[model samples]
Target: MRILSLILALSFFLSACETVKGVGRDVESAGEAMDDAIND
Candidate 1:
Protein backbone atom coordinates (compact mmCIF):
# COMPACT_ATOMS: atom_id res chain seq x y z
CA MET A 1 0.00 0.00 0.00
CA ARG A 2 2.79 2.42 0.80
CA ILE A 3 4.64 1.41 -2.32
CA LEU A 4 1.58 1.99 -4.43
CA SER A 5 1.14 5.49 -3.02
CA LEU A 6 4.80 6.26 -3.65
CA ILE A 7 4.53 5.11 -7.22
CA LEU A 8 1.44 7.20 -7.79
CA ALA A 9 3.10 10.29 -6.38
CA LEU A 10 6.16 9.79 -8.55
CA SER A 11 3.99 9.31 -11.60
CA PHE A 12 2.19 12.61 -10.94
CA PHE A 13 5.47 14.41 -10.48
CA LEU A 14 6.87 13.10 -13.72
CA SER A 15 3.69 13.92 -15.59
CA ALA A 16 3.74 17.49 -14.32
CA CYS A 17 7.34 17.86 -15.44
CA GLU A 18 6.41 16.61 -18.87
CA THR A 19 3.54 19.06 -19.11
CA VAL A 20 5.79 21.98 -18.22
CA LYS A 21 8.39 20.83 -20.70
CA GLY A 22 5.78 20.61 -23.45
CA VAL A 23 4.58 24.14 -22.73
CA GLY A 24 8.14 25.43 -22.72
CA ARG A 25 8.83 23.82 -26.07
CA ASP A 26 5.69 25.33 -27.57
CA VAL A 27 6.57 28.80 -26.31
CA GLU A 28 10.08 28.47 -27.74
CA SER A 29 8.74 27.47 -31.11
CA ALA A 30 6.35 30.38 -31.16
CA GLY A 31 9.14 32.79 -30.27
CA GLU A 32 11.24 31.43 -33.07
CA ALA A 33 8.41 31.93 -35.51
CA MET A 34 7.95 35.50 -34.40
CA ASP A 35 11.65 36.19 -34.73
CA ASP A 36 11.65 34.78 -38.21
CA ALA A 37 8.75 36.97 -39.20
CA ILE A 38 10.42 40.05 -37.80
CA ASN A 39 13.66 39.27 -39.59
CA ASP A 40 11.90 38.63 -42.86
Candidate 2:
Protein backbone atom coordinates (compact mmCIF):
# COMPACT_ATOMS: atom_id res chain seq x y z
CA MET A 1 0.00 0.00 0.00
CA ARG A 2 2.78 2.40 0.83
CA ILE A 3 4.55 1.67 -2.44
CA LEU A 4 1.39 2.25 -4.43
CA SER A 5 0.87 5.64 -2.78
CA LEU A 6 4.41 6.64 -3.61
CA ILE A 7 3.98 5.60 -7.20
CA LEU A 8 0.83 7.65 -7.50
CA ALA A 9 2.49 10.69 -6.06
CA LEU A 10 5.39 10.40 -8.45
CA SER A 11 3.07 10.02 -11.41
CA PHE A 12 1.17 13.15 -10.48
CA PHE A 13 4.38 15.09 -10.10
CA LEU A 14 5.63 14.01 -13.49
CA SER A 15 2.35 14.95 -15.14
CA ALA A 16 2.49 18.42 -13.64
CA CYS A 17 6.05 18.85 -14.88
CA GLU A 18 4.98 17.99 -18.40
CA THR A 19 2.17 20.52 -18.30
CA VAL A 20 4.52 23.23 -17.05
CA LYS A 21 6.99 22.48 -19.78
CA GLY A 22 4.26 22.73 -22.42
CA VAL A 23 3.19 26.10 -21.15
CA GLY A 24 6.77 27.35 -21.20
CA ARG A 25 7.18 26.25 -24.79
CA ASP A 26 3.97 27.98 -25.81
CA VAL A 27 5.01 31.23 -24.16
CA GLU A 28 8.41 31.11 -25.85
CA SER A 29 6.87 30.64 -29.26
CA ALA A 30 4.47 33.50 -28.65
CA GLY A 31 7.31 35.79 -27.74
CA GLU A 32 9.17 34.88 -30.91
CA ALA A 33 6.12 35.56 -33.03
CA MET A 34 5.63 38.92 -31.44
CA ASP A 35 9.24 39.85 -32.08
CA ASP A 36 8.95 38.94 -35.74
CA ALA A 37 5.83 41.01 -36.13
CA ILE A 38 7.38 44.01 -34.45
CA ASN A 39 10.56 43.80 -36.54
CA ASP A 40 8.65 43.41 -39.78
Clashes of each: 0, 0
Off by over 4 Å in 2: none
**Residue lDDT tens for model 1, 1-40:** 9999999999999999999999999999999999999999
> What digit string (tens of lDDT, one per residue) describes model 2 on residues 1-40?
9999999999999999999999999999999999999999
Best by TM-score: 2
Clashing pairs in 1: none
State in Å the error of residue 5, model 2: 0.7
